[model samples]
Every structure is written in C-alpha cells, then in structure tokens.
Target: MLDKQVCRNIKMVLLDVDGVMTDGSIFINKDGEFCKSFNVKDGLAIELLRSHNILVGVISGKASAALDTRCKHLGFDEIITGCKNKLPALVDICSKYNISPSQIAFLGDDVLDIPIFEKVGLGIAPVDAHCLAIANSDWVSTLKGGEGMVREFVDLLLINKLDLPLKDIYKPLLDKIRYDDVAIMEQ
Candidate 1:
C-alpha cells in the first residue's frame, strides 16, 4: 500500500535503468555494441502518465547509446546518465523541475538507489531487486524488472491520484486512442 498523501504529492517519477527497466541484463553484439530489451507495456505506461501530466525521467549510473535512444523515443522530461553519485542528480532534478523531493517518486533496484529512496516521496522496488533495496523501499511490485512493473506502479499512481477505481483509471487512455484513430481516419 502507498501513502495517499505521498502519492498525491508526486509531480514527477524518476527511474533507474538496468535493473529497474531492463532486468539488469547487458547484451553485447558481435560488434561489441550493447543491446537492451524494453517492455512495450512500460512504454505505454509512460504515455499514460504523460497524458495525465505527470512528468517522467531517467537516471542511470551506466551510459549506453541504447538507453539514449529509448529515452528519446519515450519523450522523457529529463535524462541523466553516467552518474554514479545520484544524489546530486536528484538535487539537480528538483531544482530544474522546480519541485521538491517530496514531489518525486523513484523506482530503483540496487544499492545505488537507496540514497534516492531516502529523499523521494515514494520509493518503489521490483520484487526481484536486491534484498537491501527491497527492504528499504516504501513499496515493492509483485513483478520483476522489465516485466510490466512500471505499468503496475503507474496503475497504482493513477488510482490514487485520480481517486478512481482500478478499472476506471485506463478510461482516459482508451478515449484518447479512440479520438486519435478517428482523427486519422478522417484525414
């Protein structure tokens, strides 16, 4: 369960890649270029969050061209990579977005993310996350990373923020899709 007050205060959601977004796997091709697998459901969850005006961003200690491309495609509000010390990035995000730490929710899966958990309004961890990380998190998703955990979190946020039943939370997205499809057909 999440604190309704905390969920209501969240204006931005930050994510840690690798463990949180990609199952912590790094695949190198024959050319030694990195490849990553992302969940389509998570992608849609991002779109849903954006439609409701909740900002999303990514912060990772590792840097990769694959991540860069994905962030671009998802239209993240902020992208910070290759930073081992994430607290400064958190401070910077707060300053840049003009929102306090209590207005942010972060999803992370390793020890590197524990500091962030202490600062943010809500800290979420995947079920398969490091034991310490799970222990420190405010909430733990039933699913593992890269397996719709983000979607699950997004559902919870929408449910709480909109004060709607779970079934109704997706109505706005469904309506948007209908509107878009109809507009396209007319064109």
Candidate 2:
C-alpha cells in the first residue's frame, strides 16, 4: 500500500521512456526513421494526472523524434532528452519546482534508472522491469510496459483520488493535441 500521505504530497511524476513506456523495443525504418510504441491509456493517464495539477514529464537516456513527438502531443511540462545521466536532470526539475524528492514519483525499469529510485519519494516499476529496478521500487505495477502499466500506476495513485466532475471525464482537455507533424505511436 502506498502511504496516503505520500500520495497526497506527490506534486510531480517523472517517467523513463524506453522500457517503462514502450516495452523496450526500438525499430528503425528503411527511411532512417525511428519507431516506438506508446500506450494511449498511458497517455490518457498522464493527461488525468496533469488535470489534477500534478506535473508530468519524460526523461530519456536516448533521443528520438518519436519521444519529442509523443511528449509534445501529451502537453508535458518538461521534456529532457539525450540524458546520459538522469540524476542531474532530476535535481534540476526539483530545483525548478522548488520541491524536494519526497514530493515526486519516478517510474523506471533498468539499472540506469537506479539513481532516480534512490532519490525519489516513490519509486515504481513495471512488472517486467529488471530485477534491480524492482528491488529499489516502492511500488510495482502488475502490467507490462506499453500494456497499460502506466495506467495501473495512475489508478493506484489517482483513480478515485480526485474530485473531478463528470463533465471533465466526458471531455478531458488532454485529448486535444496540436500535432504539427505526423503523431502516432511507433511499434
């Protein structure tokens, strides 16, 4: 069980892009384009989180237009790409928000993400995450990445946690995406 106080105190959510969001697959097309899959439910959950005033963003070790495209579509507060080291980014985010590690939740799936787990208020992992990731996580989702795992995490923390009106559910603002480029999940 998550400490309700911690959940209540959560002001931001940070997610790792590759394994945690897309099942760790990278496909390159013949046209020299990169491809990755994103869960729409995960996107919706991120929208829901943002609606409730919880800032959400992505930090990736690798860079791709796919990440840039998806994060932009989702209206992320911050998007930091090409990060070989994520802890410094984490610190910058915390500093930008004037918040402590205790007010943030981080999701990751590999050894590279260990530093974030060590410092975040809540460390969560997908079901298929690396053993080291699971060990350091404060919570683990039952679902795999790109398979509603992010939704599972959101539900745990904010399903019925908000006082959202039915109207908000009917027409979520996050559904609006201004896609100047081709915006679709890659597989």
Candidate 3:
C-alpha cells in the first residue's frame, strides 16, 4: 500500500517508453520509419494528470524519431532518448526539476529499469513486466502495456487524492478514447 503522504508528494511520473509505454515491440520500415501504437486512453489519462499539475516524461533506451514526435504532440515535460544508463539521466531530471526521488514515481517493465525502480520512492510495474521487475516494484499494475496501464495508475492516484468519483472524473476522457473496447482488470 502506498502511503498517503508519499502519494501526495508525487509531482512527477517518469515512464520507460519501449516496454512500459508500448508493447516492447518496434517496427521499422524500409525507409527507416518507426511505428508504435500508443493507447489513446493512456494519452487522455496523461492529459488529465498534467492538468492537475503532475509532470509526465519518457526515458527510452533506444532512440526513435517517432517517440520524439509523440512526445511533442503530448506535451511531455521531458523526453530523454538513447539513454543506455537510465539512472544517470533520471538523476539529471530530478536535479533539474528540483524534485527528490521521494517526489517522483517511476514506471518500468524490464531489467534495465530495475535500478530506477530501486531508487525512486514509488515504483510501478505493468502486468507484462518481467518477474524480477515486478518483484522490485512497490505497485504492480493490472493492465498490460499499450493497454491503458498508465491510465489505470493515473486513475488510482487521482482517486486517492481527489474527492471526485472515479467514473465522474474520468468517464468523459475514457469515452473520448473509445475505452469501451478495452478490458481493465484489477489484479
């Protein structure tokens, strides 16, 4: 269980892109075009979270121009690409933002992200994350990657801190993203 004060202190949510944001798959075309599928509901959740003043960012190991385009469209606080040593980059972000690890939440899905999870105050892992990753996480998401996992985490965080009912606060955004076809589970 997350402490109320800890959750309240979280001002930023940093996510790993390849496995945590997408399904850990990349499709490159003959012309070197990169392709990825982002969950619309997750995008809406991010918009809502940012509206409440919680910053969101992506730190990706492999560089992709597609991710840069997506980050620009979503208005992410920061997007760090080609970061093989993610922890050092994370340190830079924390320092630049003037926020401590206790004020940040990190969501990751693989072994490389373990060091990050260990350092951040709140470590979240999706259902599809590796077993070792899950073992290190403080909270394990019920949803799979590229399937509204981020949205689910956002909803939980907001509902705990905000007074609004979950559906009332989030349904409109969910509807806009066609979440009816998506299956959200609690694990």
Candidate 4:
C-alpha cells in the first residue's frame, strides 16, 4: 500500500490493456477476428474509481475493436491506442490535463511499460505479470491480472488515498460478485 501522502497526490490512473486489464491473451476466432474477455471485478473497480471523480484511462500499444468497445462501455476519460511508444502518449495526456507525471499512477505489465514506472508517481503491476514488470513496479498486486486485480488495487487506493473506509468501499464490489455468482448458479 502506498503511503497516505503519496496516495493523496494521485489524481489519475492509467492502465495498459493487454496485460494489466486482461490476461495478456489475444484469441483469434475461426472467423479470423480477435476477441478478449474482461473480468467484472476490474470493470466495477474502474467504475468505482470514476465515481470518485478520479480519471481513468486506457492506453494500448495495439488497436483493437475489443479495446474500443470495452473503453466505450466503461466510459474511460481517455483512450489512446496503437501507440508503441507509450511515453509520448503519457506526455500528451499530462499536457492535456495540465498535470505533471507525478500526479499520475500507471498500471502496466510488460517490459515496454517499464518506462512509465520511472515517470509516474505510482507504478503498479499485476501479480502474474512479466518479471521485468514486477521488478520495476513500485507495488505488485497480490491478485493476478483479470482476476479482480483492479478491485484490490482500487480498494487500497480508496483506503489509503481518500481515507475512505475499506469496509464501505468493498461492500459494493463484494455484493456485485455475490449477485453475479448467484446468477451463474441459477443458469
């Protein structure tokens, strides 16, 4: 967990889609189309972050319809895709927001994302991420990517940053999970 002062300094959270958002897998269907699955837990976490008025954005090195669809559905504040050089995009975002890199937090899970760690205030990686990513991250998530990783991360942020009660912040996410599980069981 980040210290209270450091967490309070964060204003935005940027995510890399392939590994940070998903399991770093891109499946091509028989029709030669790509597809990806997202965890509801991650989605809810993003929603919670948004509800707090914290900006949420996705920056992907590759462009995909799936990425566009997911970002649109999730109402991301910013979406940058098809940019291999992430530093420029990060700079652009900082320029647009009139904020310094130190005000941003980046979640990434690959070697390419290493540069961001050096730039952002807080750099985080999913548990099952690349070794380099883990090595470079300021914090490594206990949960695997696409397996409620964002949820846990957000919970930490809510608790540490705004001083929100963890029990209160966690209730909404946990309740949704329970409801979804029941729906699955009823199926």
lDDT of all the models against the reference? 0.93, 0.85, 0.84, 0.87
Q: C-alpha displacement of 112 in model 2, angstroms? A: 0.8
**In terms of lDDT, which candidate is strongest?**
1
lDDT, model 1: 0.93
The local lDDT score (0 to 100) that residue 63 gets in candidate 2 is: 93
Ranking 2 against 3 by TM-score, winner? 3
Query: Where does candidate 1 stray beyond 4 Å?
Result: none
What 10-residue stretch in candidate 2 is worst by lDDT? 178-187
Output the number of the TM-score-best candidate: 1
Arrange candidates by TM-score, descending. Answer: 1, 4, 3, 2
Error of 1 at 15 (Å): 0.2
lDDT of 2 by residue, 92-130 (tens): 999998999888899999989999999998999999999
Candidate no. 4 TM-score: 0.88
For candidate 3, lDDT tens digit of each residue in 36-108?
8888888887788786788999888878888888888999998998887898888999999999987888889
lDDT of 1 at 94: 97
Q: Model 3 clash tally? A: 0
In candidate 3, stretches whose alpha carbon ends up further than 4 angstroms from where it belongs are: 167-187
Give the worst 10-residue stretch by lDDT in candidate 1.
Answer: 166-175
